[model samples]
Each structure stands twice: as C-alpha cells, then as structure tokens.
Target: MSLDNLPDGLLLEILLHLPLQSVFQCKCLSNRWCSLISTPYFTHRYVSHLHTNLQPFTLLFECKDDQSITRVLATNSDEPELKSLAAYVHRQSEHLWLEASCNDLLLWRSKDDGESSPMSVYYVINPITRQCMALPPITLPYHRSWIQAGQFRVYIVSSNTREWSESKVLCQEGFELTHFALCAVPYKSLLFWCSNSGRLLGIDPYNTRCCRSFEQPIGWELDKETDCFGVCRGYLRICQISMFYTRFSSILRIWELKDYDNEGGGKWYLEHEVSVNQLVSKKSPWLNEHVQQKYPLPLVLAFHPNDGDILYLAIELKVLLCNLRSKTVEVFCDIPHDPDTWNDKCNIINFVLPSWPTPIPFAPLQNGA
Candidate 1:
C-alpha cells in the first residue's frame, strides 16, 4: 500500500515523531500535506506532546572577542552534556543576539557581517522545527530614547500571522535600564529586568498599559552592580550580591516570587541565602585570611522546572547546581572559556529555553478567500 493511503490518525502520529524540520519540509510535497500539517489541531497536539517530554536545561551564550558560540548544558538530574547550539542555528556571516524565548520559539536579532547597529533585524524561530520567520521592524514610541531613559518595551512576533504585536512598555520611576541584562520569560508572557538601583521590574506582555515593580528583598544589601534577575517555572528569581565593605567576604541571596498566578498578584520571598564567605573559605582557607582578596561570586541562572529545591548558578567558568533543600552545591557543568579573551570584559552568559505552546498560527481571513 502507498504511504499516502495511510489513515489520517496514523499519519499524524508519524508526523509527530518526526523532527520538526521534516514536518515543515513535508508541507511542500502537496497541498494535502500542507493543509494537514498547518492545521491548528495538529499544531496543538504536536506542541502538547513536546511539552509533555520537555527537557529543561541551562543555556549559555559565550562571546570570545568578536567570535561567539552558544552552549546548551544539561541541568540537575540530567547527564553532564554540552551541545553547541550556534553550530546548528547561526550562519557564518550572521551574528545573532538572543533576546527571548517562548513556546519552543526563540527570538533573536541578527546583524550581517560588518554591520554595526542595535539589532535592526529580528526573528522568531523554532530550532526543533528548524523553522524561522523574520519579523518586521518593531513600532514603538521613542524607541532609542526609551532605551536611554531606562524604559523599554517587549514585543512578540507571530509566525502564523507574520506580524508584530506589542507586549508591553515598562516605565517605572527610578527604574533605569541595566543594559545587557534584560531577560524575558515567554512562557509566562513576562519580561524581567534589573534596574541600576537594585529594584526589579517585571512586565506582563499581555498588558501594555503599565508594569509591576518590586524593591530588592529586605535584609540583603544588593550591590546593584552585580545582582541578577531570572525566571524559571514561572517564578521570578533575584540574586542579590552583598559584600562586607571592610572585609573581602561576600554573600548571595536568592529570592523567588510566591503566589504569582496573575499579572500583579505575587510577593517576593527570601528562598535561600548562600554564604560566599564560607564557600570561598572552604575552597581555600588561606585566601580568606588575606582580607584584601576579593572573590567574584556567581549569579543565579534558573530554577529547575520540575524541582523546586534545585537552582542553577553561573560562576566564572562553570555552572553549579545548588540544592536549596539539601544545602549542597555540586558541579552541574563546566563552560568552555578561552584564556585569550578571558580579560576581554564584554562577555555575558545567559539561558534560552524551548518552552511550550509555540507561537499561534495566523488564521486565514474569511472574506479574502
């Protein structure tokens, strides 16, 4: 019997198991396949299956000098494996800046060879599907001014419709944009940014009117210079950097958002506090004895989606898994660092996840046809 004669149910099951790239390529084989693959029903079912077996991991983007590479490392409970994503996603002549990710969709801005600008090219892609769509230039009010004023906006590009939709504009008093530190949690339709004053600003992509703000948790002195913000499993995380001015001792405070079911209904709670002083002293007792020795601690990367007690931290050269409940820190994975560019001072490491419920497909216009 010919493959085309297969039942619709059986064909769908086969398509679901195929790599996303194969499914997309099959669309060009015939109209029947295109219509079948592009249907909302099939996309929903396929995405649901993707979510059911999602493998949450830590993503790190490393830029050594002018060259860059992306590494996707395993999280706690997973084997120590690192996959270079740039080899699969980036081109030889294109330099891409990852912006955010949602629904298995990754957003990025690309600059051509020798191009110098703040991302005039934007894209939304699903690496699993091996599909990508370019987004039109975003429309915003005073775009550059907003970036300079410490106010900014988040926008979502719909692949189904091939149009740009405004998420929200975050303009809060005393919230100055910390350039190179803004991160988005697309699963929750939220954008998180840490201000220069140790305050965190979270914006609901669904709501464009205003954003919600929270001061740094009490009892912790935030350095504002090194604190980091991130979200995992829909919980907002703030890693505060504290140092004893007189001594070289340092401390890290991890805070999470509790009761964040709605746009503005969550409150910040102190989750775990890691003693950098003890950590460093444990590593080398003689180093701590010298009061002038300063250790640059790590930043919180993301919390494990399935485990509440597990979180990842990115130190200078490695990512560590801190089991808050167990109070034990173990090596999750080691990131590659080039000694040549180690002192370049412009490198930043962050994560981009493949979330569920991929971008909604564009609905055909009824009157046009």
Candidate 2:
C-alpha cells in the first residue's frame, strides 16, 4: 500500500489496531509511516483504542532459565515486544507478580545487589507512560523472625500520591492459631485463625480490643480444628463459621458482609450463593467447548471496574461478564489457545485491574525500564 495515498486520520486508525511494538516495526516500512506513527496524535490513538472497553487482561507465568525465572507481561493479543517490560522486580512469586498491576501503576520488589538480602524495595511503574517511582526503604515494625512462614503483600489505594502500605501475613503453627494483621494501616487490626479450636478473632489495632467475633455453627465443627478457610474476597470477607451450626447441605457461599461499630461484625447475609450442581452446569457448556479439561479453581470473581451492577469472572477458555442489573451472566471468549490446546505446565492466576496509580518510584532504568 502507498503510505501517502491514505489520509493521516485513516493511517492513524490502522496503526491503532496494532500493538506499540508492531507500530515500531512498521517504522521500517517507510519514512512516512514511521514519522506518522511517532506523532502525538497517532500515539494517543494507539494507546486508547481497544476492541472492548473491558479493562485489558493479561496472563502471568514464570519462565525458568537456568534456576532463575524472568517474569514479563503478555496480553491476550500476544504482542511480540511483551518482553520489553521484563527485568521487573526479579525475585517474586506468581502471587507477588499478579499483585503488581493496579489501575495503571505496576508495583514490584527486587534485590539490592550490594545488600546481603534481596532489596526490600517498592516501585510504581506505568508501562504506557514508562514512568516509575521507587519508594524509600520501608521496614515492618515487627521482627521478621517473629513472623512464621511469613509473606509480604502491598495494597495500593488511590490518592494524589498513590497510597501504599507494605504489610506481611504472619502465621505460627506452634501458637494457638494463625495470626494475620494489617501492619500498614492505622493501629493494627490483627486477625487470628485457629484451625484446631475453630475460633476466629478480630482485634482492634489501636487498643487490641476483642472487637467482635462469630463462631462458625457447630456443623462447621471440623473447621474448628482440622480444616481451614481463607478469605479470597478482599478486606470485607471473614470466613469464620456461623456461630450456630445447621445441617450442612449447601455449597460454599458468597455472603454479603455487614459492618458494625466501624468494624466488620454481625451476621453475614448472602449476596448470592449457587449450589455445586448449578454452578457446575452453568460452566459445563463453556468447558465442553474446550473438549474436557478440569476447570480452574474457585472461579475468580470481582466487581466490574466500570459497572457497579456487574461482576466479572475468568475460566480457562473465556471471560464471564455478569450483568447485575439484569441478573444474567454472559460468556465472552478472549483467551488465546493454539491447535496445541492441551495446555499444561504453568499454574493460572487471576487478578483485577489496578485501581491506583503511584508515582514511578524506580531508579532510572538502564536506558529506561
């Protein structure tokens, strides 16, 4: 095609359909296409244009290269330059990598070459803008040794400066129960889970008050000791059993959480709960389309970023967009699989779009990260 033949706007539209890397490649096609793609007008269109306004979704997987794995971002579109963002916080778990992305800011941690230990670092980077803010050193008040089998998680809340509180989840099998507290928040609301005693506690961070707690009904008795439940939902979720036990005849529930005295207390009213059979049947057609593969775990669910009345879920083969307004669920296909679809090898992780963007707190990348 003759580059000069097309109107500038038409050329811009064509470039918008391609990923940034491919646009870079087109630079070799001709000086005109190259110069036009570099213009602010074309760059803006290329950044914002997406087939679905649906927040972009990407998959996270670790590649083992000589006992060291490099993590990178690969969208459903499979842009070839997805590896350009490689060299992020190098030593991290799948969960940590999945947690890095928020609205537009990506947070990650890496090792400090000079220090004996990996760098206890945090940075906010925006791939689109390619800006990063590396935060000053932050240390948890408690001794690391005190925390048993501990792991750290960072929660980024939206603010002018992008609020982030680095915290760790601590547990001790030797103690009466496993302890979890929010170290980054005002005061510390520590939660205690006793798989042996079937007890759950919520402690006021400021006064260490035994705020309020509910015991799962006796029917969840085994949960008191041998079994364990973790909150997959965010801050509002508490998985302690009902204080009273009834016949156990239902599936896992998504009970609506209620707040009391500025703390989560009182009975949990279910927002919605689907039985095992119905939930299975609903996903069956989609699974059969895959020619029979075990479905991914506790199907990921989250509030749609743009719509309050809807929620979104991800299965192996497709994304399920549920309309809360109409109380109907619609299945959409966006996942990419080749003719070699019998996929295995890596575990799948699900995450929502980041809601906050932090300043790029990172040191200047070598020629820019």
Candidate 3:
C-alpha cells in the first residue's frame, strides 16, 4: 500500500470501512485518497463507525429555511458561516423538517409521513443543552373494541431523553395491545418495542415506569407504517418496507424483543424472515468489492444521517452503504454499469437509491400498485 507511506486518515479509516461505491472509486485512487475520501467527515466517519447502534452527529433538516425560517440542521463542519449547522426551531414547524435520525437524535414529526393524524417525536434534544420535549404523538392506544386513537402510533420505545418528565411509561389509554416501535437493543438499552400492543414494555425517557412488562407471541405485527423504517440488524429491529408481499415474500421481518416478561400477552417473537433475494445473493461478491454496489434483502436501515456507528441501508432504491460493523450486508446488483447498465433498466432506476432524505422533493413508490 505504498503511494508514499499511505495514511490519509488511515486510508480514510479503511475507506470508511469501504462500500459506497468504494468511497467513489477511491476517488480515482490518487488525489490523496481523493481528498481523503471526499470529506463530509469521510462519510461522517464512515457512518458513525458502522454500528454499535450508532449516534455520532446527525440533524439534516430544512423543511423551509433558506431564508424562510424554521431550522434545525447540522454540519457545522467547524462552521465557516454555517456550512449547514442551523440547529433547532419549531414554532410552526414551518413545514416539517425531520422524519427520522438517530445518534445525536432528531426524528421530528408533527403530522406527516403518510399523515393519518396524531404523530409526535422531538425528544432527545440537547441543542447544546437548550433542553426539549414534546413526544407522544404517533397515536393509537387500544381495546375500546379493537383500536382507535385515530388509528395508532407513538412508537418511541425510547428517545435518549434528557428530561422526559422524569423518564417514561404509562400504558393508560385503552391498553390491550396498541402498537409501537422506535427501538435499539443490541448491546441493550434504548427501546419501545410493542406490536398489536400487548404487555411487553420498558419505559424511561419520562413516560415514567412500568419498567418491563411481559408476554407476547401470538401472530405479532406492530409495523404501523411510518413508511416502516428501522435499523439495528444483529439484535434485530429490522423493519423496512418498499412495499412487497407476494403474500409476505418477506423482504425483512424481525422482532426479537426480550428482557423477559409474559403476562399472557407479550414476550414477542418471530425473530427471522429476511430475504431481499437472499440479501441480493449475499450482496453479490461483497458488492463487487466496492464501486457500484448492490442489494435486495428485506433491507431498510437508518442512522447515517451523518455518521455515528454508521448504519444506512435501504438498498437499490436509496440510503446506500451497507455494513460497517455488526450488520453490514452489501449487493447493489453488481453496481458497475457505466454501460453494463449495472444490468440495465436504469439499474432498475438509477442504482436504486443513494440520495434524497432532503434536498426536499421526493416521490416514487407506486410501481405494481
């Protein structure tokens, strides 16, 4: 590896654990690891270390601000007049900013992401200790004759609370099984795991204690689609849906919520069923050793909003760069097509998806109906 004693940030920290088209073909391998892997903190430290359930520096919102006001962005890449770091603001939400982000937290939701009404998340705020809280929106409580709190969703198994009323949990509403999510539990801690909502809980983040409830494992299916997005694939929290189901071809379906507790209702189960075409054939030759990648698995991961245990999956259709530490699977359908077409059809439409969470304007998801 001698180009004159290579160390460009340790070969961009091993090309930030290589895989985002091999960090852009190692930037033609030579302009100094292509400006040290095209700095954005080298894909934010290759996605915040590729895992450990992540958290490194995220918050890329801009629902309006460009001058219209309503911010909370971040990228103060050491600021120089806000390379991007706006911070926070929500007096009218302006037009909605965050939809999901973790590891320095930010998931902001006012009433969008399919908008059925009653949806909330804005906890985990430390805009440098300004302190914030206003969660409990994604509604749905349960049993008043089978669900109705506008239909359900408040899935915040945990939000790294800084003040959450003194740490959460109440269950109240109508409780029989309400439906919940927003999770993290690989090395343990950070949760809100429920489905069809039974009795398995673990609260704190100021919803205030029940601490741990149990019993769950009947049919199991708590994915009240907020476009169903989750990440944490080795201790499972997998949930991702690009909409498919030749009757559940199962492009991913995991649910392993344990800490033990069963009161005839929940302990939850079904810990397996992910086959995005066998993770696109085990990520085709390890994503052809990086450049144009590939993927297919029941894939969908998040937490690369700008690195911190860098886990970003949602392959061949956006949110690229899979695998960093624990759950790193890669296969962009042999992404190479300068003309091979990465195997044509616009590589099934422009190498799937590797851009757009913001820059605003988004659409596409209707194919096949």
RMSD (Cα, Å) for all candidates, in order, is: 7.0, 10.4, 21.9
Q: Which has the greatest lDDT?
A: 1
Query: Global lDDT of each model?
Result: 0.56, 0.42, 0.38
Ranking by TM-score: 1, 2, 3
Error of 3 at 237 (Å): 16
lDDT of 3 by residue, 89-151 (tens): 434344444444333333444533343554444433323223345555444433224442322
Worst 10-residue lDDT window, candidate 3: 343-352
Ranking by lDDT: 1, 2, 3
lDDT of 2 by residue, 1-369 (tens): 675798878887877776554666687798988898767776556545652544444444333322444443334433333344333434334333322344455555443334444435665666544566656555434332333332333333333455444433333333344222221111124443432334344544323323444454333435333222233223233222222224322233333334434555545454444332233225445543332234312243344334444445455545556444454455644444221232222223222333112335445444444
Using Cα atoms with residue i matched to residue i, what is each candidate's TM-score against the true structure? Answer: 0.67, 0.43, 0.24
Name every residue pair that clashes in candidate 1: 104-355, 150-177, 160-362
Which parts of model 3 are misplaced by more than 4 Å? 1-55, 58-69, 73-96, 103-173, 176-369
- Over the stretch 1-369, how does candidate 1's per-residue lDDT look in tens digits? 677898888888988876555676788888888899989899888778777764545454444345554433343333111132344433422366655655356666664444243336776655544456667775344433333453455666655576778653645665675544555433255566776555766665546564666776667563455355665556777666677656555666777877876646777788777665444323434434331243345555555655667766655565666666655566666667632234323334433344232443333212211
